[model samples]
Target: MGHVTFFGVVTFVFRHSAGCTGNAISSPHRCILVPSFEIKGKNSMPKMYRTKLAAMVKNFPRYASANQPPNGEIRSYIESAGHTCELRDAGEFQSPADVVNLVSEHPKFEAALAIHLFKAGRLLMDIEIPFGVIFGGTDINEDVKVEQKRVVMEQVLLKARFAVAFTDKLKEEAELFLVSQSSKIYVQPQGIQTDVTEKFCWTEFLRSSGVRTEHVDELRVFLLVCGLRRVKDPLYLVEVFSKWHCENLLNVLVIIGPKIDPVLTAEVETVVKRTAGVFLAQERCQQELHAAMKRCFAVVNSSVSEGMSAAILEAMDLGVPVLARNIPGNAAVVQHEVTGLLYSSPQEFVRQSQRLLSDHELRERVVRNGKLYVEEHHGVKQERETYQRLVDTLH
Candidate 1:
């Protein structure tokens, strides 16, 4: 794939046969000149700069932390393109001094990128090195609600040379809130891949959860995957889901993810203790989580805010039908009644779950369409190429 590159931008010449031998790319729009490693320019041979990047990213623990996985994957693309990347946890940057300390520590780093706009994107402010911003969910969806934070976010945007949003909807949100950044912001949907443990025992997993009723073979499991936090809204569907489970012995609801917040974890723990068929499973690795998704009836998302959800995309790629909260982020990925079901409230979720249970043809159609959507949009090759293009800008 050939990418359009700017005249001064040191980028990959993707068009091999287009006489892009040297790194200098010629096009009306900017071109991604470097398909293979080569360089050229009209004035003179382009100067080769440092390949090291200081990538400050958010990382959550235990299981399926959204930020860390994509951070790792995209950097892998950057590294494969011959860039040395240092992935620092963005959470550690409490103030501007922390960022200055990081830059001082890595004297050879040519550039830096902050993964989440609100969390670490502010670090880009007052830095001399060229930098970019990657918008995470809460940064735009939640943080922009505050006046002080919005002012700081605007500063971060003014300083950023480039930015990446996980979805077009997210890009729109950023542009709407901050204004005049649409050109620099690129819409890159996440690449999808899932490796399930073939030997994983669904029965064993169920038994361990301790929320399954008898005749487990006949039960339908719905997975709600997210790090336990207020934004994730882990408790959103609990009351209705518990009621639905009690009304039918063949249904169960399992909440699984790392406990990101101790306070929220306690609240969920208390609810699951008394709620029948509502189990709280410990967060599993990506492989194990995929195995659960494969064996489950459907996956659910009830987030108050989202950037691009890896779990939702992973579930679709795995051929698991999804029931997501009707939000811009989820809606951008999931087409209601086509790719997956979308419910506005808990009652709607119960009704929709029942539809997924009773309507055999609908299930098959949704599953098929969801899988096709993933294949078309989110693939390993697509992401590798996108990141390769993105990293080239840092040059």
Candidate 2:
């Protein structure tokens, strides 16, 4: 209800046009627009909940943003507010048998919060503790399609002390897969923080990314950030992007992120070697990545599905306009023309990318709006406080 300026106007027009309700947005710096449900007591100060927690994360050495989730943030929020937290990496939601065997020997904690439903939640089904579950990108979108996983996920939900969703759209998509647990599902958008490295070397980055030194400033770099995985559909736009680069040598497309999947990584490497003007950049630290993003013309998201993209949010925070594949999760963050451009097809993606290159007014508007959206809705303080409040349910 504040800042009724151009940002508000842009948000209002889009929400109405898309028939979005008051509660339809999210912030990863996602801008989910949902308020945190606090746990204030009557009269006296509210009691703080403090205890050790076994927070589960996608702990893969080749993963870029595994720690970029509610579990990672909540660990600090809980500890800083007077509690201890331990992170357990159960990468890829494989079998929970290994984790279950380990927790059986560890010291007990007060409560727990896990990122993926089946991975962490199911891991603790027999651990005997109150816990909350945060949905992941593939959890609600792809994995739940199978009947067995769907049933187990539902069971996880039925037993969880609480569940967190990055956006309302994800919550709805979840409802279609299982019986509605609207009462316990919290639409708390993930919070993102960006920090760039000091004196980052663009030339070094280019060299590492397989770009020629002579063509540093001559090329317009459009970065695609994603961990190499099947669900991410890293190759969805590669063929088209390669074609675009062939037509215009100045148009460079770089895929930068961790090699999450060995098979997918080999496939991507082969394509990049054979492709024109498309390179695979080395994975940089979070700070370096942010710095590289600043130099790029724009950021891109070609994920088949996303709960919310920390990369896109980081790009917007760094004043880089995003060109995202049009999917429900991406759409929740990007308001098409208002915040960023969305493309349903690779052809549309090229068209939008060109607009960002040639249409100054359009690009400027989106960049400004994207930054405003991130600031207004997503903040470290906001997410921390919200998680603290949600975790209080275990008390």
Per-model lDDT: 0.68, 0.66
Model 2 residue 373 distance off true place after TM-score fit, in angstroms: 0.5
TM-score for every candidate vs. truth?
A: 0.85, 0.84
Residue 213, model 2: Cα distance from true site in angstroms: 3.6
* lDDT string, candidate 1, 299-380, tens digits: 9999988787888888888999999999888888889889999999999999999999889999999999999999999887
- Regions of candidate 2 where Cα sits further than 4 Å from its true position: 1-48, 59-63, 66-71, 92-101, 104-106
Error (Å) of candidate 1 at residue 6 is 24
59-81 per-residue lDDT for model 2 (tens digits): 32212542236333455565444
Candidate 2, number of clashes: 7
Clashes of each: 18, 7
